[model samples]
Target: MRVRGRLTWGRRARAGAALLACVVAPAVVLSPGVAVAGAAAAGAAVAGTPVCQVRDDRLREISGMVATDDGYVVINDGADDEALRRIFFLNQRCAVVRSVAYPSRPRDTEDLAIGRDGTVWVADIGDNDHSRPTIAIWRLAPGAAKPVLHRMTYPDGAHDAEALLLDADGRPLVITKGGSGTVFLYAPTTALRPGATTPMASVGQVTLPRTSTSNPFLFLGRGVVTGAASAPDGRRVVLRSYADAFEYDVPAGDVVTALTSGTARITPLPDEPQGESITYSRDGRSLLTVSESADQPPGTRPTILRYPVAAAADAAAHPTGSAGPVSAGPGAPTSVRPAAEEASGAGARPWALVAGAGTLLALLGLAGVLRSRHTARR
Candidate 1:
C-alpha cells in the first residue's frame, strides 16, 4: 500500500513542535531557582560525548541506528521522497559507505536490529495515527542485495511503535509507544514468514517511572519509547525515550521478564532536538545515539553521541538464553520523583507558562502550514 501525502505534513508538524521545545523553551522560562535545579540535575547525569558528525545531508531524519565493527547502519523515518528510503551504511567517520534499497517504499521505518549472524531487521511499524491494517519487518541477510518484507498484524488492533528488539534466537519483539509511562510489548506467536502475514501476541507491559531529567520535550517525553537496542553480548537491552535511556539486564535471556519485572538503570539524555535513533557500541561498553537534523539550521549535520555504560553495569552483563515467556507485574520504578514536578508547579511556574505559550504558538503555526498545503492540493 502507498503512504498518503498527509503523513508527510504530519511529520513536518511534529518536527516544528520539537524545534520550538528545544530552541524556544529555555530562553523564555525565567525562574532562577528552577533554572538552578534543572542545571544541577543535568550536570549530575553524565552527558554523551560527541563521537562523529553525520556528514551526509540526505540522512537528516534518522530514526533507527545499529553499530557494526566497521561503522554503523541507519534508516530515515519514512521520507516522502522515495529515493531517500534506503538503509544507509556509515563508516566510523559517520560518512555514508554504501546504501541498500528496499524492495518497495516503506510505510514508516522506525527502528533497526541486527542478529549475531549478520542479519539486519528494519521495523516498519510506526502508526502515528493508529490506522494501519498491518505492520511489517524487512530483513536483509548477509550478502543480500535487497531486504525481504515480512508482514505482521497485532491481535488487538493498531498501535504506534518505534522500538524493536531482537532476542538471542533472532526473534523480533515490538514495543508500543504509549503515553503516561506505560508501554506494551508484543512478539510473534509463530515464526515470521516473508510470503504470509504473521500474528503477534502481547507479551506484557512496562511502566517507565517519572524522572526530573531535563529534556526538550518536557514532561511527556520521559515516558515515550522512541528507540531500542540489544547489546552485542545479548546480556543487556536498552529502551530510549526523547529524554533518557533505560537499560535492563537480560538475565537468562528473558527480555520480557527483564522489562516487566526488573528496574532499569536510568541515564538522562537531556536537550536533544529530536532524538530518535539509539544503539550499543560494537564492544557493548557504551551506548550510541544520534538525533534528526531536520529541525536544525541549514547545512547542519547530526552528531553521534556516545555515553559510557557504568563499570558496575557492564560487569553484570552475562549471556542470556532464548527469551523466556512474558512475566507478570508491571516494571518497577528505578527512580521515583514527585509527579508535581511534571507540571513544573510552584518552583517552575514561570518556565511552565513560557513553555506552554511556546507550545501553543508552535501548534498554531503548524496548523496554518497544513491548512495551506490542503488548500493548494484542493
Candidate 2:
C-alpha cells in the first residue's frame, strides 16, 4: 500500500526552492558526509525521523506487541521444535509481569495480535521456507487454559504470513509477508479449522522498504513484520515492517479502499531495526515499540521504546525514556536498565552510596599515608 507521511508538495516545494536559492548563495557545509549526501539526494529526501528507541533486554525474536489493560504484551517466536514461544507481559515501567507459553506447534508461532475483548491472539504464521499452506492462531483469554487453536489456510496457494490484527468486533485480519504484501480480513464469526479456507477479502498490497545499513541488522527479505493492530476507534489499522511502521485509515469498512486510497502514514524508525511490533497504550495517545532479542547480542535483553504518537507527530521526534529487559537466568537480578545508566535510579541508591563512600575512603587513606611519610621525612 502507498503509505503516507512523505513530505507534502507544499513542504517539498518550499524546501526545494530554498535549496535552489542556496546554490546562488554561499552554502556552508556542516558535516562532511551530510554535505555530500545532502547535495546528492537532497531533492528526493524523505523525512527520516526516529520517534523513540528502547533497548529490549527480554525480547527473543519478538514478533508482535499488544497494549492491554495490564500493560504491553510482547511475543517471542523461537525456532522450530524448540517449543519456546511465549508472550511476555511488561508494565509501564518496563518491568516484566509474567510470561505465558502458548501451546505452539513446531515452527508455527510467528507473530501476535490482541483483540478488543482482551483475547490474546497468537499467530503461527512464520514460514521460514514458505512450505506451509496453513498456519494457526491460538486465541486465549488473559489467564485461560491453553489457547483454543484457530487455523487459517490460504485459498490460492501457500504463503509466508507474518502479521495479524483483530478488529474492534474481534474479527481476524491476517496479512501475508511477501514481495507484494497481501492483506486478508477473515469474516467475522468464521471458524478457523484445520484445512479450512475462511471467507477472506483482498485488502491490497504493501511493501516494506529496507534500510541502507544493517546497523540494527534485519533478517533481509525474510520480512520481519512484527506488528499489526486495529486502531482503538476501529477506523484505522497499523502494521510494522523491519524499518518502518504504517497506519491506515479504513473508513467505509472497505479493505480495498483503505489499501489503495492515499490515506496511510509511514513513520521511519531506527536503522535496520528488526523487531517492529507496535501497540497503542490504554490512553490511546502513546505508541510503544518493542525490539527483539534475536537482533541483539546473546546475553543482551530486550527493550521497550515509548513514543507519544500525537506528540511525536508534533514534537521534535526523538526517543523518550526507554525500559530495558530483565535477564532470563537466575542470579541475573533482572537488571532492566543498563548498568552505567542505573546509578541514579531509586533502586541503585544503596549501591551508589557504597561506591561513593569507597572512592572517598580510598582517596582519604592515600592522602593520609602520604602526609605521614612527608612529616617523617621532614
Candidate 3:
C-alpha cells in the first residue's frame, strides 16, 4: 500500500478551514522484537541519571522537538485520534507549561522546526504504512490556539521523512527516513502552492549498516530514525538515530562537510532507548533529546533528556578517543518549577484546586444539613 495524492495551491490560507476533521494497531501487534533489542543495546550505552517523566498514555511516538521563544515545544505522533497530534510547551527549566493539539487526519508526525519568528512547524512526514499520498505541516504560535495544517505533496508521490529542519532563513530541509538514508535539500524557493512542492534535490546519502525487518514494505522498521536539525548559520546540519549521530558542514556553495560520526564522543543514554527526537536551543548551548523506552507498557510516558552542546560536540568530534561509554540513569527527575517563581506560576493552579475542593465540601455540607432538617420534620 502506498499513499498517493495531488497537492493543492494556496494551502496556508485553507488550513484554518480544514481544522476540524480527524487509530493505531493493538499495542503488542506492532512490537518488533529485534527493534526492541536494538533499543536495549543503545540504552545500555547512554547511562545518564533519569530525567523527569512526561506522562501521557496517548503518546505513541515523539517525532521531533524545537525550542520556541517561550520555551520548548515537543511534538508527538499521537495515537487513536488524528486530532491527538500534540505540541507540548516547556519552560526554561523543562517544565511543561501548556500543549496545543492540531486538527489533522491521522498521519505520521516525523519532526519539527522552529522558524526565526517563532513559527512552530510540525512535520507530518512519517509514513511507515505507505498509505499517505502527501505529508503536511501544522503551524501555530507559541501560545496560539489550535494549529493550522499546511499540506504539501512530494514531487514523486510519498516518501518516508523522519527529519524536519528549517535554516536560519526559514527554508525547509527534509531528511529521508530510510535504511539507505538521503538528505533532501528543499531550497527556499520551494513554495507552498498546492501541487507545487519542488522535488527535493538529493545532495547526500549516508553509508550505514542496514538492519532486518519483519515487513519488507516498511522502510523504517521498529527502529525509530530521527534527529535532523540545522544550525543557526543554516550551513551546518546535525543528524542522529538510536545508535549513531552525525554533524555536517554545509558551505555557502551548498557543499556538505562531515564533522562527526556515529561512534563519536557523546553522553550515553539509558539502555531501553526509544523515541529519539532532537533540537538545538536558541542560544546554541544545548541539544535536547526526548526519548521513550521501547520495553515500556504500551501507554508508558516519555522522557526528555538534555545534553550540553559543548560536551556532546566534543564527544561527537572525538568519539573512540573519548570514554567509549558514559553512564546514564534509568529515568529523569521529577518536574519541579524554579523556587522563586514557582510560588507565583503554580499559585493560580492551586487556587482552582482549592476552589474545587471548597465547592465539593460546601455541597456535601448542604446535603447533610438538608437531610437532618428532613428527618426533624418527619
Q: Number of the top candidate by lDDT? A: 1
lDDT of 3: 0.47
Q: Which ten residues in a row have the lowest lDDT in candidate 3?
A: 20-29
Native-to-model Cα distance after best TM-score fit, residue 363 in candidate 1, in Å:
12
Better TM-score candidate (1, 2) = 1
Q: What is the per-residue lDDT of model 3 for residues 1-378, given as tens digits with 9 covering 90 to 100? A: 011132111121123112210011121123343234334444344333344566554343565777656666776653444434577777755576777766645366668787766778777666543445666667776567887766565555556667776654565666666543334433223555433443454444443223221211121222334666665545455565553344444545242223212322232333324535777656665556766332244555666665554233343544432333321222211211221232234223434344344435433543342223210000
- List candidate 2 stretches off by more than 4 Å: 1-58, 80-83, 104-106, 180-189, 193-203, 207-225, 252-256, 294-299, 310-378
Listed in order, each prediction's TM-score against the native is 0.79, 0.59, 0.57
Candidate 1 vs candidate 3: which has greater TM-score?
Answer: 1
Per-residue error for 24 in candidate 2, Å, reads 31
Order of all candidates by lDDT, from best down to worst? 1, 2, 3
Give the per-residue lDDT of model 1 (tens digit) for 1-378: 123465443356456657776754564355444455556565566567999998777787888999999999999887767667899999999999899999877888899999999889999988766767889999999989999999999999999899999876788999997756799999999999989999999999988856656666565567689899999999889898887888887877888887887656667777676778899999998889998645455556788998876433333343222232211111212324444443454546646656666767775765464344421110
Residue 124 of model 1, lDDT score? 94
